[model samples]
Target chain A: MPILQFVERDGILDLGWGHPRPGLLPVRQWQDATRAALDAYDWQALTYGHSAGPQPLVDWLAEHLGTVDALTASPGEFFVTAGASHALTLCATVLAAPGDVALVDVPTYHFALRILRDRGLRLVPVPRDDAGIDVEALGALVDRLRGDGQRIGLLYLVATFGNPTGLSVGEPRRTELVRFARAAGVTIVEDDTYRELGYEGAPPASLWSVDPGGPVVRAGSFSKTVAPGLRLGFVQAGPDVLDRLAGIGYVDSGGGLNHSVALAMATFARSGAYAEHVARVRAAYRSQRDALVDGLRAGVPGLDVPRPAGGWFLWLRLPEGMTAESLMVVAERNGVSFAGGAQFHTDPARGHDHIRLSFSLLSPAGLTDAADRLAAAIRSVAG
Target chain B: MPILQFVERDGILDLGWGHPRPGLLPVRQWQDATRAALDAYDWQALTYGHSAGPQPLVDWLAEHLGTVDALTASPGEFFVTAGASHALTLCATVLAAPGDVALVDVPTYHFALRILRDRGLRLVPVPRDDAGIDVEALGALVDRLRGDGQRIGLLYLVATFGNPTGLSVGEPRRTELVRFARAAGVTIVEDDTYRELGYEGAPPASLWSVDPGGPVVRAGSFSKTVAPGLRLGFVQAGPDVLDRLAGIGYVDSGGGLNHSVALAMATFARSGAYAEHVARVRAAYRSQRDALVDGLRAGVPGLDVPRPAGGWFLWLRLPEGMTAESLMVVAERNGVSFAGGAQFHTDPARGHDHIRLSFSLLSPAGLTDAADRLAAAIRSVAG
Candidate 1:
């Protein structure tokens, strides 16, 4: 379908949208932040701004990242984007040419794959295990592609709290991956959108933080932590990389992404409201994740569901002989819905027996009811 | 110079930023409108939205276009964009593949040309006259390109109150251009960014309005009329064209451009605040344009300064023996700045004796002073 059908149909418990639930959105906080921004900045808030974004926001973001991620970055190293998806699009344009090859995790964020492919970059799938992308396998694939006379442009990974899979690469593995990429002369684009949404404990050090000053471009978004409709995110890279990105005609011509909104977010960030909101949402999602995991385990026998420490999803391995597509049919019949894992895979056959359920978009009660419906559907499908 | 330097320096009168003057921006109105929107829509304003945009904003834009442009279009005919530049980028991607030919007006909006070229489209400059893009020249260029076994993918023009020229294509010419494009199997992308900012009377019928179902795609921006930082704009096209654009991975994956901002704009539009703001900005720019034209004519004898009835710029043909480059050096020495007309031209040599003066970013007194400085610079350069 040309348009992704994401409308919540009546009576269907949908777990497909990988976004925060409506109740978790910080509406009042944002309104106040915007008002404060407009009042303080006046028309400057509404003017066409620098392509890197407003200086205050850029400065604040740099410091904020240092405080939270233990990563020190110069102001020139940051560029605000419309969102992480937009950041990925910009990276695809600046980092690689149309015919270049990008190495991506097999069960990657589907839309990230779409964004890269749309830029005409060929994607080579690198298989992943529970520890995240298999670094040795990726290294071998890079060498193989090089042997075939192919130029490997970029290595894309959801290095922290990955989408759909919810696996984070360990710090040592991240270091190894970065070393391999630098050795192979491939740029690494770390999708860090979910890094700050840790439910149980802190996620591992980001690939960018682990190998600062290396060829790592990290993309982070406010969608998971703040609000998606704001369409605000940031890309952090070395000065050289950022300069190249800032030179893209889209940014150069338009003078930055989401300027007024970015200014409002800066106000929120400075006022300590953003952190508070993120904490509240993180707590809510943590409860939602617990409810979904506990309820699904109790309801469905022999279903291997992994508990994600951060991010939105819980990856469920279907019982042997029960395919995700078959379960989806029964789930839909029972008025429950989820993203079939096949959608996340470059090769659909590899993920047929898995499904990705999001705990971020439903209430705790709604999640429990969804689990019950899903269990009932599974029993019917097995029969 | 990969990043455009638009920073306003001390003690310099800059006419380089073709944006509304600070005092003219409707700060209070926007603050109120945003507050109202947040109160009314709450979390819906902050959630991930549809790829085409929020339905209310889309519907309002369709109706607004119908009322203002005398065009009839269904909601599906409009797609929200970050702004006109982003819209142009999206159109470049959807309408033509890389390495295809795009016939653009010679002195077109420079950023439009940049957007197309950045997408790897080969830009073929078609000469334009006072009336607008020279239809005969464009036709010949298309035919010549086709004769060379190349595809003429699209014809790009700033049909209404064109940037750097302020020439609107008459209705008859618009019809002719659309017919020619349709006959030649080439799409027409009319940048109507400044259409609504007409200072004298309403601008001519948009190319899309003139031929609603033809291969005409009209791009309009609230950036000029409302606020640039909102980053809101829309592309009006036949349902087929819009569907194709909406199907682009950029839109399908990101869910839409600037959703919360669009919703807030819709509220402002529905409340009639947007129209009032446009009228206010138009009046201010009109006076500024008039002051510039009068001041320059009186100061620099025999200079041909065309008074723009609408939009932001005044195109001036320098007196013989005075190149825009020489004038710019003298003007900069006198603490005044303006865009050398060559910057807008695909072939720089064609516009060396011309300069573009933007009255959009300065007060009447500031513009008058700038005109005096420019005239002094011209005289110095002539000597």
Candidate 2:
């Protein structure tokens, strides 16, 4: 197997991982950007960088984030991280302590659950609807947990086009999310990683956008829009948060993590290549998503599949009396694989009947085939 | 202003930062390497990579490191990191807890001191002589600290070509250090970052090499030998240490940090470009070291300076009654700025009369000029 991805297997179709499709990886664009970045900065960009980030990229990120959030954003509010995952790890390192409670959306990005657990954090799941997190339920959980003597350190939210559920908190709910953080004495880490890929226009204003300096730290990533291998992202945060991040051992010692790559990103962003690239990727993923959703609905009888507004995943609430585990075993027999819902939940007892399918890593035709295979598996499991 | 470095001032010379010289940043080599990497891997390198690292680079590093350490090494024992500083941070996160006692070399890399301190590790300076750390004394101190109910976490050692003071722990002492760690039940993080940059024939066998799969974790970096901005390095350790690192939140979530950069590094190393690059840098630094030392000895009467075997710095022992603080004041007036020794000590009271000057960031002529300026400062300060 290749280090970055699994090689082609005999018959299995992998719709399991959230990794971007291999076909869409832009080699030419990166080559051009690398060439241009070196030409522009020369060797000056190769030394120990400013801890915040490359200035060109930092300033550009500020402006780019402003457009994405539909608000005025400044350079001071951004801290460059390796990725959303890195941002999460860093914040967990500096802001939260071991055994602190991290409230996450049920059926959240499953990998995030493991990441937080490895940090020694206790994960608690909050209820979610199609429009995203239920603020009232989250508030109640916080109250209940605090009353039980558990310290709720943060609520990790994928507010704009979240991972598995492909859900967004409505504008009012975003405001509530921030307000709840303040009232409950918690931080709301809004992962705006997929904000740019919203096919149904923009999903909603960011939690950070709703309250700029409030207890919300928004994570932005080029992984979805650009390339995951770049391993570059930024956190849109308040000054206090940035200071805490900057003062951590890693950032303080090494400056920014990927300085050379950021320089390329700076030139890429400055020259308008990033925007164009995101648009191209967005259009491609939209088609792939539609193809899969349409096939799932038509091919699978009585399957209640919600059409995601944006992002890569489609959440299939399993057919009556059918479980994700049984479907997964049958799916494997039928040459299709998917992430089962139990993987995403903090509480294992929940999410027995849900399946998350990624629409980003295969062609529309490939996904249509995957949909057919999945339909067969579901039918066999239901029988 | 550039985010990665300081722009040239009108008249000042900076021997302060240990950043690689801008002139030798090897922009073309990186550009070539990037192109080759993309072509070789296609889109395979553009996704979430192996948590250990890219396999090609990992394997190549294992072989290359064997050559450097003068012992056999294997791929399974290597864990790629962002850089040396990152290795320190990661180990600190896993191997120790806040308030754990960290035994450090006195007058070590000042930035590392800050990095460890920020991680909330309590640093206790272990006295050093020219031959490197006194294992007998360190054992006694460890016994004393444990006797006092302090949990001694790890000893941070730059075993070869250590920063601020270009020193290496001798071969027999390296063995003794590992035994000490075993007896004391502690980890020894040997920062082998500058090992490959030896201007001399070679430094001693690595601490890890002396006792592979023992209590040592050796950190290697492309920063000194290639480009710091690449933020690429690795750790050679036993299975237990690699597992601890790979299981960390950041690595688990993000796969590996700087995957794209590592891909480029893989091609660079495999093609023999890395060996060529290291040789060139070593030769350049050797001349720069000689030029500065000779200039200082001739220009400044009775100034005691030790010729560094390898790496970037020269430790200048101040003349009788002349302190580093007083010399720094005069040096600044003469348009030379070098790092003061007090910054490197864990305790504030030590290192009052020693100075550390980097020979990496300037040309031979520039370093010679800097030496002359420092000599003038020394005379003025002595008077």
| Tens-place lDDT digits, model 1, residues B211-294 | 686889888888889888888888888877788877776567667678889888889989999778887888888999988999
Per-residue lDDT over A126-176 for candidate 1, one digit per residue giving the tens place of the 0 to 100 score: 866766667788878878888998887788888878887887887567788
Candidate whose TM-score is highest: 1
Q: Report the C-alpha displacement of residue A208, candidate 1, in angstroms.
A: 0.2
Q: Which stretches of candidate 2 lie over 4 Å from their true place?
A: A5-8, A127-130, A140-151, A183-185, B7-10
lDDT of 1 at B213: 66
Cα RMSD to the true fold for all candidates: 2.1, 2.1
Backbone clashes in model 2, listed as residue pairs: A49-B4
